[model samples]
Target: MIGVYISILILLAIIVYLYFTKRLSYLLKSKRKLLFKSLNKVEKWFLAGSLIATFTFSTLTNLVSSVIYELVSPNSNKEFLKIDEKQDTSIELISESNEKLDKLLKDASIDPRDIEQYLKNLPLKDGKEETNARIDEWYQARKISLEIKELLLVVTKVIFEQNEDLTNTITFLKSTGKTDFAGVLENIQKYFQEGDAEKIKQEYFSRKEKVEKENILILKQSIKSTEALFAFQQTVDLYKELILVEPTAENYFQTAYFLHKLKYFDEAANLYQKTLKIYRDLAQENPRAYLPNVAETLNNLADLHSDKNEFPQAQEKYEEALKIRRDLAEENPIAYLPDVATTLNNLAYLQNVKNEFSQAQEKCEEALEIRKKLAKENPKTYQSDVAMTLNNLAILHSEKNEFPQAQEKYEEALKIYRNLVQENPRTFLPDLAMTLSNLAILQNAKNEFPQAQEKYEEALKIYRNLAQENPRTYQPDVAMTLNNLAVLHWSKNEFPQAQEKYEEALKIQRDLAQENSRAYEIDYARMLIMGVKLFKKDKSNLKIAKGILERYQEVYSAQELLKLIRKLE
Candidate 1:
């Protein structure tokens, strides 16, 4: 019985220690609460009752011990317990010091008096040194933050002022159609004049991507406005700056497009080749994602080659694009078949240029068949394509001297255009005019002079109206019609009328050549040659024609001009 009592006492002592330290409760709380809640109501009640009994027993034991101690020592002169003065004071000091240190760490704005007292009372050398080092670090951090704030304010002010000036300048430019770039030019020049050239270049280059994006937006706006050519050139300049920053494929391609439009064919082709190489590498990595872009670039490159008269290169590029389009069409016919048809048409045009008539006809036929099916499904959308293909076929027939077949196709195309114009005259009038011109040429070839003249007059009227509205794009068309008229009169031996028409055509061609000599110079030289032929009978007229030809010595072959001069002498 005594042993059992001692075991119970030991267990009670362990329970008391665990309860005071919270270890037993902490272990229960750390487990999932759901496990305790899973007990039945009776089991929960039993556990509560047992905990209450244990607490009562512990309290009774503590009270009994105190009572016994009071009775047993009531008469003793000394007290049962005495506090240790030094050790108790030491513990109190440690507790106070810990509270003060915690407060200081938690509150950065503690009273200075309290902080001084606390630091002075710090008992260890290492603690004092550590606190001092932390304070120094805090001071340095604050100093750096203040300096950064000041620098930011200065930079913000400078940027705001520059932005305000730039905004006002841009508003002025827009209001004035940007015809005078003097103010903007001055603003750009000011940067160079005020700063080191290398520094200014670096600054411009650092923001070059942003500058390129903004310039591209401006270029789009300029294209819609009357100052498109000037804006295009400015955009090209921006692209050059972007290249200086980073010669990216997209930047090169953008520059190439503008260069092509500006008639800088060689430069445009070089850039396009660079873009093509980059796209090719990218396509090799992810063909499905990038092959369409490759095909588009190839198409543009082919057109560029065609414009430059690099026929073989153009043919090769067009064929490559066609093969890609064919593959894409096979994968998703509904979405990509139109691209296939378009590529076929472009290839056909190229073949026609190369005088590969049989191949050209086959490609044209295939394209027409696709377009016809597409038109049958959605006439409103694809009818124009069908008519365009018909016109192309008619031209091919005419080139082959199959007059009846050419006339049939021309009439078919004309009917389509006429119907289309009835629905939207502004859009389709140009097509009607083009078909009329073709018909007039066909009539002239067949010696139907009166009908040819009537058709030519009608086409000229349309071209004149179009040129009056947008002279930059359509003025050359007017010159072309005038040249055709001159040829018609020349064929009939109406030298005086032919000479007048040729002179008018030459004047327009001269003006066009002033803007793009490579595009218009050959036409100007041809007009001079026609003038020479028309005025051969009159010595004074012959001398005038010879002088005009000599003036374009670079455009015309010297040998050919000399032969003409010898004939005239």
Candidate 2:
């Protein structure tokens, strides 16, 4: 088809050249002249020969020029840089690469930090002498990296140690495998006392600099089989080569997964797109194996979009993935049904965001039904998923004013979450707290004030504990719960309790807003307004609220400030 188009284009070009160069006008000297028929045989033969010669010569010249230019062009090399899904690689080669990768990764972590800290602490700037502070940084980084690498390597070995129960996914997920390499850090610290810092830096930090250089090739666009796949730069280097050499979907998919986890969203999206394209092209020939991959990639990309608040793109990709999963699940329910439920739950939330309440309810209910069956079969695997779906369902029921239905779902979801938290608090505590908070909201709406207060206190306790450990992540949750409890108390005319809760919540909000006004200022403002309304007659609180409003007047507007102050009056 391309050849045919090129042939037609060349033919048009020749005619245009002849017309524009006046060669055609030479044949049509006068309107009345029948030039070809009126011409003598010799003249006619000469015209035909000239036309044939010109056409042949022009075609050959253009073809030769195109060949030469393409051979010399820089863009000819660009194709090699991209992962071409249709490249004709030998099946044997692909299989060999797969086997090699499988052997390497089957029992391996692929990234044991692998001198990552060493690489990071190595002096990137090399103008002046390395300061003692710089040396100290490198020493500390090495000490930390080495210990982490040792600990993770031990864990990985235990987890994937060719056990008889390797297929027991639950055991792996819930593995409380403890490392025996505990006192190694203490020993290192004891030997490398504060006075021996110079010697430690000389022996450890400087020596590892040479060793860590091998990882830099990920940037150099070279492939090495031994490189770690966790650090951003190193993984990019290794995977880019894998994509170029074998062009497998796994290569792109794994890289994208890591990048997404590391918050490299843009590059992760690009790799996911490439992975999806490859899976799609491969699926045209082998749908059974690659279609699942296509759906998975779509789901991941949709998640990335949702995280970035690109909701339209997220919804579109999720629906595409959902359709694919639903079709696959009809044929192989056990294999693909979970994916169907997962996508349904994802889309349900998106629908709720778009205010498509009916569709959201439908999706959530469908997901809940699917997950319930799956959880019955494999409680350890699918129970959390069931709980998640139920939580969403309860919210949908609440949206439609089905209080009893919403209450029932929320209770069931909280029961599952609380059980899961008992088994693995590190994993499911937050889930429990979140459901408790939602249930409390519903209770408050139903005016079950005492029940609401109980649930709020429970959630607030969890949030306070969590905030003590990770204030940056859980402080906002703490403040929000406090505000809820305060309002509950305020509505009951419990002024002392309300004042205490409101003061605590507002202080947290103020601290958080100081660090990130864009995220927390509105919450601070809302709490302030609540406080002012609750204590309208309290001269001290009103004065303080007015002062805060005046301080933040520029953040909103002077008119907005005056109106806020008017509410206090």
Candidate 3:
């Protein structure tokens, strides 16, 4: 009894110590700035190495460190978060402008030139369109015109050639629209008069580097997290220059895979083609080394062609790829099941797209059988891919107007996307929105208006928020949604709502057309025609419509106006 009691006491002490050390390390460590800073390179390395060697230690350490660091780091001088309010504001404004412009441009009812004029007049400072846009935003937000102008001068010098005039160089930045030429020219003259070239260079490069590094870091994180194939493709492209400087098959292949995933068929196809060529040259010397790569590339190329709507081309490529896959599967059945299933699905998708429904069905079923079997064998490894194949099959059914089947597939895909979004909203939200939009469009087509409307509204809300936040990408989509909503209203005979939405869309499009007078002018003419047709009976509105049309007719073809006017008459 005494010996047993002693043994129990020792065991209890060990358990208590293990718990405290492993789980409550945060309680022991000082949650202080000095302690954090004291974590030197060697300590960090050791921590990392130890974490890798002992997952439990690393996990606990990371958890404790993260909680403590976050709690304590708030007031620390080491947490240097230097944000330029001016740049943030500028980005926001550009995003707003792009959204507005996309709406106006989509319907082709507004005069592009007039829209351009409106954009030019929307209170901007001059440089390049992007520069002016940034300046305009910054000016409105921070009132730092002199500082911005100096920065622009330096940017022009650094990004362009020695002989390039700062004014002209800044004037030609057409990313947003035409630069305000007169305003940019004045700023340039002022910059030269100030005689602060060196200061300008230093400020410009610092900001530029800061912006570039910030974007690169964001992109790196995005690449790791994003499920959207196109976004991932873009992320890969942004890093392409950096990766190209240190080229390897892994980097190249990953980028190529991302491109392929995005349905950028031409680019993806080219990448795979190059990859295959490399494999082919090496195949003679090292058949074992290169065969797998060649096979994968062939399969990728086949899928690329399939996406491009080139059925025969896709078929040929898939068959060639399949021969290799089949041979591998025969030699190593267990190892090759996944690849074989993937090839089967790709071939099926191609056939489905080509309207070879029966063959496609068979291929999908085959792939499904393989995937299902694999998923059952190893749920964690194969479940996601199985679900993907299920969705593909659902897509095939959907194309055939097999609504029940398609809905089932969509439900599965939605579940997956929803879970993904929950885990990483920033990376997966866009995809969720896209899927919602697609499903909504289908529902609308099927006359499920309420469900469709709900889906569209939800998607529009997310897209609008995204566009407002990242105007570079989502703004145009928001405009499109607005236009789509207008059309929906118009179809329902909600004339007032339709007109309001259309006008809202037109406002955005007009802002975007600032650089292209001809484009905005065309759009303005179309809007005039629509306005005249819609409001001809209202005498008060007709007068303004006719007046606007007459002024716009000077820029557009007289014949188009006369035709519209004749309709009114």
Task: Write the residue-wise lDDT of candidate 3 on 28-136 in tens digits.
Answer: 4644455445557975575455435454544565677777877876532221122223223322332334344433333223322233222333232242455456545
TM-score of each: 0.54, 0.58, 0.42
Q: Rate the local accuracy (lDDT) of all candidates.
A: 0.65, 0.65, 0.56
Expressed as tens digits, the lDDT of each residue in 464-557 for candidate 2 is 8876545666788999999898888988899899889988988899999898876676567666666667765354555555665665666554
Q: What is the C-alpha RMSD of each candidate to the true structure, in Å?
A: 28.1, 19.6, 20.6
Q: Predictions ranked by TM-score, top down?
A: 2, 1, 3
Error of 3 at 312 (Å): 3.7
Candidate 1 lDDT over residue span 295-347, tens digit each: 87898899899998899999899999889888888888778778888989998
- Model 1 error, position 150 (Å): 51
Model 1: runs farther than 4 Å from truth? 1-234, 241-249, 377-380, 467-539, 550-569
lDDT of candidate 2?
Answer: 0.65
